[model samples]
Target: MLYALGDPVSLVLLLLSFVVAVTLHGWVQCLVASRSGLRGPAAEGRTRPDPRRHVDPFGAVSAAIAGIGWAKPVDPPDRRNRGALLRVLLSGAVANVVVGLGALALLPLLTSSVGSLVTFLGPSRLLQSGIEGDLAARALLFLGLANLMTGLLSLVPIPPLDGGRLLFGLAPRSPGWQKAEYQLDERNIGVAVLLALMLIPLGGPQALLPTILDTLAGPLVRLVTGA
Candidate 1:
């Protein structure tokens, strides 16, 4: 997502925004897990907002290439507590969206220099958002957009991502579900499939991940920015 920009300054701004967004996503998940009564994240010092502590190397590469990537998995202190599973899993996404909208909500409050409607237009227009926009404001635009996109993208029902594991945890106990989970989660099949979807441009509407983000992330931007 940040790579498409022709301007070096814009690219740098976007790169920082993306890194911060991904870091925030992981930190929030860990924070939520700690607040939800899980101690492992806290015990391991994963609660800090450090990028080194959270960003997965492959996930970072994926974010640069596909615009939708994830952070390192945040597991509960006790994975046996299935009830805590939903809270631990869903918090990451909720954090991203809340941060995204929160950034948008604070836009009008920014110094009028950069708080113009251009700053509110959303991620799609970011590339052509007119270089006159304030760097800080443009960074916020990228932050909000990247967070929203990451939140949605992470929800795709595939393995390795939080959403897929969340679904697997929620499903009723069944031999089929168990076997499928074993193959996808245990055997790494889902990880391979997810990589394919992100790395391969399967063409047309079948291009899956990009299409999903394009279709969904845009409206969120418009809705929040009032554009």
Candidate 2:
């Protein structure tokens, strides 16, 4: 059940989660760009911050609707740091996974409190207690599942994703696979876009993904929080 509160706690958490996700996305892009020799002027140690130097707008918006998002890309790192490209490329997805795990850990605390508050607030309040409770539960569930999905999805061996970077890093050493690896990066954007469009018809933001996440998170929440 939901408690009627003037405080914007839900809004705050939502915004914070978005920021965390976007920042990780940006850092990952920066790492990948540097490794791929796509550095902009800023990477040369220029002092000015150029908004233009960051983000693929189409990609970011698509992510937002799809429960994933990207930030503006950073200039590539210095050549000295280039050797760490694979690590950098994978870092964003790694960060997302970490967030997912963290959410799972924290789910009990969030759900218990929200559930209790909703019940205590009673049913006649402006905000229906039961609905609020469900939303809060769903939000926690989404946080964990969204992060997990983002991490896993980005690992697909397509360009602009973490998997693509891993494939490139490994391909050069593999006998006879170099040409195929090179072709992957060239079509990364097209592939990613196609995937995003396909996902949209599968239920937009509110359908199957959320349902799957809630289903996965439910048992864990009940086990930990005794809900």
Candidate 3:
């Protein structure tokens, strides 16, 4: 819904946030892979934080609508080191978490600066009062909270997601683990299951996508807001 005509301000904020989140995620993955001695696609040029180098088309659109999206996968070079693989797989998620926290920490500053701007401009008294009220504050809060929720949602363990790769890296190469990997392949039914969870509406006023992100991000958002 990036082009949706409703609520342009919020849509733009969320679109920008999603872009930054995915860029950070891809760059971190490439960095980790490069450091792990794999000069693969990510290490070559995908580490530049450019959308063309990292963002998948469907993934980006889905993210704009669902609040959680992914970037193109960066395959690591042939290496038998499980630890290195784990690091590469987990780096993207770590980057998202870091970005989300940084955004949260900036919320108060953003609102305060907006206040200062309004005061300096000597806006109408009514306008000043409204700005000092919840509008700007809520906007900043939503920006922060949206990024946090998106990052957390990216950590859901399903095929082709970072969390799924994390699990594969962590598990030993046993029969069960191999079976799980096979079943969780990118082209398998796992992707369908994930999409269903994201697209389905369970109850009033909210779909499963936002509901899940909210549930996962609730505690962390509270901690960040000191709520």
TM-score of each: 0.80, 0.53, 0.75
lDDT of 2 by residue, 1-227 (tens): 12213335543444344455555555555555555666553354222322334335654444444444444324333435545666556666777777766665676765555334323331111111113345666466445544554565566565556565565565555655655545545545545553454244464433343334334434543444454
Please, what is the whole-model Cα lDDT of each candidate in the order they appear?
Answer: 0.70, 0.47, 0.60
lDDT of 1 by residue, 25-45 (tens): 889889888887978888878
Clashing pairs in 1: none
Candidate 1 has what TM-score?
Answer: 0.80
**Which ranges of candidate 2 are over 4 A from the true structure?**
1-16, 28-55, 70-83, 112-143, 173-184, 187-227
| Per-residue accuracy of model 3 over 43-87 as CA lDDT, tens digit each | 359767786787766566456555566766667434367778778
Residue 198 in candidate 3 has what lDDT?
62
- Which pairs clash inside model 3? none
